[model samples]
Target: MNNSLTNRLGELAKLFFKMGVISFGGPAAHIAMMEDEVVKRRQWLTSEHFLDLIGATNLIPGPSSTEMAIHVGYIYAGWVGLIVAGASFILPAALITGGFAWVYVTYGTLPQVAPLLYGIKPAVLAVILNALWRLGKKAVKTSKLLVIALGVAALVLLLNVNEAIALLIGGLLGMFWLHFPAKRNSPEDNTNLLIAGLTTGATLKATAAVGASAATASAANVSLWQLGLFFLKIGSILFGGGYVLVAFLQGGLVEEYGWLTQQQLLDAIAIGQFTPGPVLSTATFIGYIIAGVPGAIVATVGIFLPSFFFVAALNPLVPRLRASKWTAAFLDAVNVSSVALMAVVTLQLGAATLLVAKAPYVDFVALAIALLSAVLAIRFNINAAWLVLGGALIGWLFFTLGLYPIK
Candidate 1:
């Protein structure tokens, strides 16, 4: 490479690496930092073009912040910058989470650590609930979209349908129901159309769910290749943000394969929130638990690989994508469905974290932590990372003082 090109790539690497280390609070915070450094400070791209990139990332699947990093790198340093920027941004979080995974695997069962996790897990639910509320307001704009969200929720929450399948059903149904001109003159006709659409989608979800159930294998003998493939599929189809990932993991890992217990999944999410950069770093923690260092490596690469491909492919089509109504309709449906799925996962996690199997049947302290966390997050607009840390500190203090009993 020329000296100028090499220098530019190096600059890209340094900037993104720094952001990766400090970019906490999830995708929104990550993007705000990028905007400041890349646009306001560095003058790397104009605000208009940066907004276009954001829209493009939304059009495609993957973490929007990570994709934005890749997009900026591509603009500044070409294909190599794409790799460098993405890896730079991901490396810090992956490494940090990997270290935590090692510690968790080694000492998670100890009394001291258990209480810390006790608080963090419920706080994670609050975080996910916050994301669900924010995304739901934006995605569910129309009554038709509301019907779509409810339908997708029913499929996943009640029928035990696969999340990916439910998402596809929602998107396709939305494209047809929202985009196409229908001959519905009255409220009765509109209601009938929505009912028919939900019925058709449910039928499809049921059929897919049956096949999906039969195909799931136990993860007791999971191979690295299988692990990589699972995450790759997740990366390709994941919409909304990192919070949406719980739906996919809850179904595939916890229920289908039994690779992780509900508690383990909640712990993984808490670790992800505790770290910086993309929340998908939870993959690194999860991979380590399932298969050690090799698993962590494969899982991280597999889950992040799709984002690079998506950003590259979608970057060129941003203008066209932003103009198409059909694309907008499809994205709206998929987004609402993703939010709906997140809502279901949040409820499930709440039950897992706030309710005990014996005696009291409820952990009132955990419930109080969750309520406080939610108020701080929604009403007070506190950062999620702070809430997580606050929960950890409170749990540790409560346990140390003999106030909160250890389960």
Candidate 2:
């Protein structure tokens, strides 16, 4: 019996480890890959339950998708599962980013591997688009939900309202519409109230992260602890994945602290994207530059440590929230808002991705690949890793044939 349990734990570790290695295109893609594995392939959780977890992550600070992995780990295998899942998921990216850090420090330049990302980015877009479709179908169940989702998207994409604020407002709207439609509250509204209190408090914490930066004071010599603490704080606070991380790092490390230059930080972000797993592994690259192997270790731990605790603390409440009618409404609001934010990010990324320099018609090859991949995903439900690899090979062939020349 114990061996069977251990084997199950091993499976959890291996699954997340594989995901850590191949998860490209950032958090949306990572979450899509996870849904394929955990919900569709493994049947570990239903789609509805997974949506609840995703919504819960939005409420708390830290990397949302990474926290999703941790939450799944806890749900399936308890505390050990949480550790194994989060660490296994993070390990590959951290090591890859750490190696890049070594290369950067040794060479003073990030490796130029445009062909790989060129192929992978389009494929990732297809995967993310498919995931959004599936989750959006589940999230937007009511006309009211459709309105909330659309409103949040407009606020984020058009009005440029804060994403965190948009999500919180969605939750508040859910609290009223789902729970008190006629100004009548059931006894369980109190439970939803408690859940709302916890979620709002966490949402406020996430909102404050926008202004977060590295500790004040620039120095010619930077300490390992400072690097670790800086990333740890950002990891615990930043909510919108790599996009937000880029701005935070630019301000803190480049402007506030003299540890890295603007170019170096951009180089770090590029390397982070080129590798698999979390883009937050950019911390590993910067950490190794600042200190060394020890710095790499500390930075990775500091950034990810809070995710473990955040999941453990917030995950249990998801079921409680879903179990009650009122809090369930709250979860629905948060879920739609989460998917709405995903849509906004996808639009922004797609715009940036479809534009290519020195190419005829702005990255025609990638656009073709992305369109093809999207059709295949929708029609056949193909595995994402295969699409990524296939995209890479196609890009490499184009480069070799000089059909799509990289200038």
Candidate 2 stretches greater than 4 Å from native: 181-187, 209-221, 355-362
Highest lDDT model number: 2
lDDT of 2 by residue, 1-407 (tens): 48866887899899999889888888888999899889887899999999988888888777777889999899888888899899999999999889888888888777767877778888999999998999999999999998999989998888888777898888779767866766576678676668768667866766575665555655456777787888788877876667778888887888788778878888888888789988888888888877789878988899889889888888877777888777788889999999999998898778777886553647777799999999988899888888888888888888878887653
Per-residue CA lDDT of model 1 for 1-407, tens digit only, reads: 99999999999999999878767556655665576578656889876567556544544567888998999999999999999999999999999899899888998841235767767776766766765664566667889989998999999889987665677778778877888855533564354445334433543443333213334555567888889988888886676565568888898899888889899999898888768789999999999999999999999999999899877866665544334565556656766776676567667777878899897899999999999988997788666557767888888999989997866
Q: How far is candidate 1 from the true structure (C-alpha RMSD, Å)?
A: 8.7
Q: In model 2, what is the error at residue 6, expressed in angstroms? A: 1.3
Candidate 2, lDDT over the whole model: 0.83
lDDT per model, in order?
0.76, 0.83
**Model 1 Cα displacement at 46 (Å)?**
15
Error of 1 at 39 (Å): 15
After superposing candidate 1 on the true structure, give the runs of residues whose Cα lies further than 4 Å from its correct spot. 1-85, 100-112, 182-303, 315-319
